[model samples]
Target: MRRRTPRVRPAALAFATLFGLADAAAQTSYQSMGRLFTTPSERMMLERQRSDNRAAAAAPATPAGPALPPVPEAAPAPPPAPQRVGGFVRRSDGRATVWVDDEARETTLPRVAPGAPLPVDLGGRNVIIKPGQSYDPSNGTIQDPR
Candidate 1:
């Protein structure tokens, strides 16, 4: 015949019974405990968002300043003086033609009359003609030289 062996310890058996009862009680109460309410930190974040929205809605609509006047346009300036190059004296034609650096230019005047000094343009350097003297065009020199 085979010998019989002990299967459970007295202290271990009592501890197992206590643990099973505690697990059953926890399971039964799980649904009865309601969900946690909103925390303080979440409430503060919501309040801050509400304040920001209210401030944006209350902001001013128009800019603060007086209107500016319209500006007027300016007029254009006059042309510059012509540069003289040479002159001519015409005794026969009774007219002198003044030559400018630009060939297209021709300023003519009556020839120097008696008792009046002859008008002359020495070269493209200077204008030696006195007042009332005619500018000559035939030659680049003054006629009736004083």
Candidate 2:
């Protein structure tokens, strides 16, 4: 009596072939790949390797002169200018002018809810922000912190 073999799907056959090829290519070594010690080497071989590595590492292959003093690298460029500051809120508006110590500075801030902390930069000084006040670039004044 003749035995019948199971028929394989063409898609499955192709997938199996491709997957096998990719896996074979990815795993090219016949030896153990990782530190899991799946296939350990002979004790003598490991001892020999360890000894060779120790000898090679203990002494520099090349005879080199004393190391030179390392020249200090230039100090890193100063950090970027401070962008934001912590302070009390004076007004919450998208368009507002600010005063940076005698010099009037025009700055725009997003609209903020009433009673929320308003950001007021008074010439690098602390300033309190009032609620419901929009930051009008034209009129920059009286933004003093409480």
Candidate 3:
């Protein structure tokens, strides 16, 4: 018996030829044709692109007008002086009044609760008084020093 080789059918040959032509055409289309910027048309396109980029990079100039003057800082004001006074509250109504020597001003204190000490300010000194504590307005005494 003699051995014979298998032969490719007509349809198979036509399909192979079609696939080969498609592959060749795809490769030719995808191949790079050097750098596009080397051509004169491409160089003109690049120059226009660079000019647009430069125009964008340049900042817009400010309009000419009157310049704003610098603001001046304000000077600080002086602090107020201290005050001192002396007085006692009435045991019955809890109302008290005091007079300051330095300012020659008199101020009445609000009603204090029972058993609460009375506070007064005169010149720069402060004095507190309990019930039966005598306060001297002339010498600014907290207690009887005699």
Candidate 4:
């Protein structure tokens, strides 16, 4: 009886070599071109920041100039008018429901503490309404709880 030896196929060997080379090329290209691409505006902003840093580093220390008259601060703006009416309603399931006059649906609102006062814009007056209490939107007054 004669013994035969096992042989490797040429096509299979070529496919394995091709895949190995492709994987290595992909890793090399990613390492070479991995810098993040930025938009034109971002590039300009970065350039401006770099120039400012360079200028500050190059400038020499000098004595302060004469103290100019202190610029007057602008007056603070007034508070905005109330836009809508809303309040909290305590549910039997230990959660509160927030009802807004303009919104179509009421959402579950969790309070930091139970019975905490929730701010509501009633007409033009800002009123603090507690859970389980009702309010009148027309007059901005609290109504008897139902």
**Predicted model with the maximum TM-score:** 4
Q: Is candidate 3 or candidate 4 better by TM-score?
A: 4
Encode model 2's per-residue lDDT on 29-66: one tens digit a residue: 54446554434566667788999999989986774888
Worst lDDT 10-window in candidate 3: 80-89
lDDT of each: 0.56, 0.56, 0.61, 0.65
Q: What lDDT tens digits, residue by residue, belong to model 4 across residues 1-146?
A: 99999888999999999999999999999999977745888889889999999999899967599767989999887654333334456677755556655453344444556667676544445567664566665445676455
Per-prediction TM-score, please? 0.24, 0.26, 0.26, 0.31
State how far residue 33 of model 4 sits from its true place (Å): 9.9
Cα misplacement distance, residue 72 of candidate 4 (Å): 10
Candidates by TM-score, descending order: 4, 2, 3, 1
Query: Model 4 misses residue 119 by how many Å?
Result: 7.0
**Per-residue lDDT for 80-131 in model 1, tens only?**
3333334444545544554444343344555556444433343343455543
Off by over 4 Å in 3: 32-146
lDDT of 2: 0.56
Q: Candidate 4's error at 85, in angstroms?
A: 3.8
64, model 2: CA deviation in Å?
A: 1.8
